[model samples]
Target: MSGSAVRSLVSALLLMVLLAAAGCAGGKKEPETLTVFAAASLTESFGTLGKAFEKSHPGVTVKFNFGGSSTLAQQIVQGAPADVFAAASPATMKQSGAPSPRIFARNRLEIAVPKGNPAHVAALKDLANPAVKVALCAEQVPCGAAAVKALAAGGVTVKPVTQEQDVKAALSKVRLGEVDAALVYRTDVKAAAGAVEGIEFPEADKAINDYPIAAVPKTAHLVLAREFIDLVLSDQGRRVLTDAGFTAV
Candidate 1:
């Protein structure tokens, strides 16, 4: 009785090992790795959506390189090997040669001031005060272009001590109290929460910035790239972005 039981146990163990090896060889191809270069402004929302995408496509690892839109675009053009690039503004996407980039969302400029708006910059025109240190995005980026347009519409010229490379950087000046105010997107001020308060300017609408997303043309993982881009335009993605203060496009 003892010999038979031992033989049966050994045979079962051998079979189990063989099955495990087979599973390893045949299991759904390991999740593909998709790298994304996204604008810093999308940090919170994309972080949420990336998790959802990973859940839906089990085994797929989503890695993000969040930075200034123009910077990210330059990296892509210089061959950063990202699967996808999502910019805070369409003008940035153009820098990466992302032809036909889809406008997935839109944002409008707002005046971001120190918490409680100590300066009480009630209107856009107030930004021109010589006493106030204003921060602005460089005109090369979409937000900066929008800021210029908005100022022109208001018939005032802004003199920011520094022209930041991105909206977040410009906003950072205000957040750090280095500047009295900054022209950034409403979504950014919202994301900052208590750090900054957003003041809506009537001229913002005429210069709204469109956020665009595109599958990087140099992507080696085009399948996964397209998949992630589709996810960005999907209903679930829209919900996340909208909740983050973006207007879905």
Candidate 2:
């Protein structure tokens, strides 16, 4: 064909391609996002549950905000835009002002020491020794509250070198060798992937923490929130939680 004919054909093809691309873009629907505010200890289990939820429900995305339950509750109470809230304790869920919270699992504190147990830490009372550097969660958080009760039950007093805002933060101190040990949830120690080892004590039984989950009352995605909570309370969810060292409630 002549040069002008060839140029005209190329221009027509380009226009057709642009129209097709625009049509595709216009036809696509944005995936709906379900925002879950969960305690830091639920990171691995909830992550797996979120993936399963997404796989089962097409065109939906699961987003998570993991932190101290108390902090997450405060964020939700301040209207940070959350669909669901799963707290390490019912108190935190109540603090979030999210109604109809349900207990799904339970957890207990354990002494997390470095893999080698360099400080020769073995029991809750060992934390009281001035020679042992211990990390702990802040008193406002569930893990910290449980720690206090457990320590009390054991008649032990500890002076922590650093108090973190969450269980994961406290556990990190032990994993990083920043402290000789940390009082964290059993699940947290299990999630450490061998970076730290857990030492169970009788006092932990006296301070078991109940985990609660709820659909945020002000959530725009209430349906998704409830469904996620349902998944968390389901048999499959129990298996996941149990494998992660949480006790099924």
Candidate 3:
């Protein structure tokens, strides 16, 4: 072949090779991300479940947005992109308008005190004492509502030094020694066992919160959402939650 003809042929072959490389690259799909909006209390257990799910599901990533159930519900209602929601209460789950939410676990409140129980907060009523500085979740959140119910059941009215937006924030007060005591979920206390002590009160039973999980109505990845929920409700999910101090339903 002439020099110009040979050059033209080489250019054509190079173009074909580039096109073939592009086709192969396109054939390998990018990983899909499954976003979950879950209650702050579910952080530990869900973290474990997310890793397990990613291992079982290749080319898929589990992303979590953990916060107060009420806040998470409002976000979903406001059109935040989410695949699934795990709420700390059915009431919060309903607010999200996620169809067919199912209860997966239950949690109860406990008095979280500093490592040594510096305030000597023994029972629910102790929180009412003026000498005790307490932190509590706001009433709009599940933990806060449960705290209100538990306090009412014990006929104890407390004025917390601060009202946190989520259970983790409230628990952080105790962990940081910023507050003498805080009313938080049993699971949170368990997760922070080294930083605080859980004082179980009889009144907590009256305010046990039922956790619910469901795929969001507008989920983009419907199949992945359902699969993640399945994993959360599976036997392994139960063991993870139970180990984290949540009562399996």
User: Highest lDDT: which candidate?
Assistant: 3
Q: TM per model?
A: 0.87, 0.88, 0.90
Please provide, for model 1 over 4-117, each residue's C-alpha lDDT reduced to its tens digit, 9 standing for 90 to 100. Answer: 999999999999999999999998886578898988778888899899889988898899998778888888888887888998777788889976688888888899999877
Candidate 2 lDDT (Cα, 0 to 1): 0.94
Sort order, lDDT high to low: 3, 2, 1
Q: Can you list the residue pairs that collide in candidate 2? A: none
TM-score, cand. 1 vs. native:
0.87
Residues 19-107 of candidate 2: C-alpha lDDT, one tens digit per residue:
99999998866789999999999999999999999998889999999999999999988889899999999889999999888999999
- Candidate rank order under TM-score: 3, 2, 1
Q: Which stretches of candidate 3 lie over 4 Å from their true place?
A: 1-27
Q: Please give the range of 10 consecutive residues that has the lowest summed lDDT in model 3.
A: 22-31
lDDT of 1 at 129: 90
lDDT of 2 at 89: 94
Q: How far off is residue 90 in model 1, in Å?
A: 2.7
Clashes (candidate 1): 1
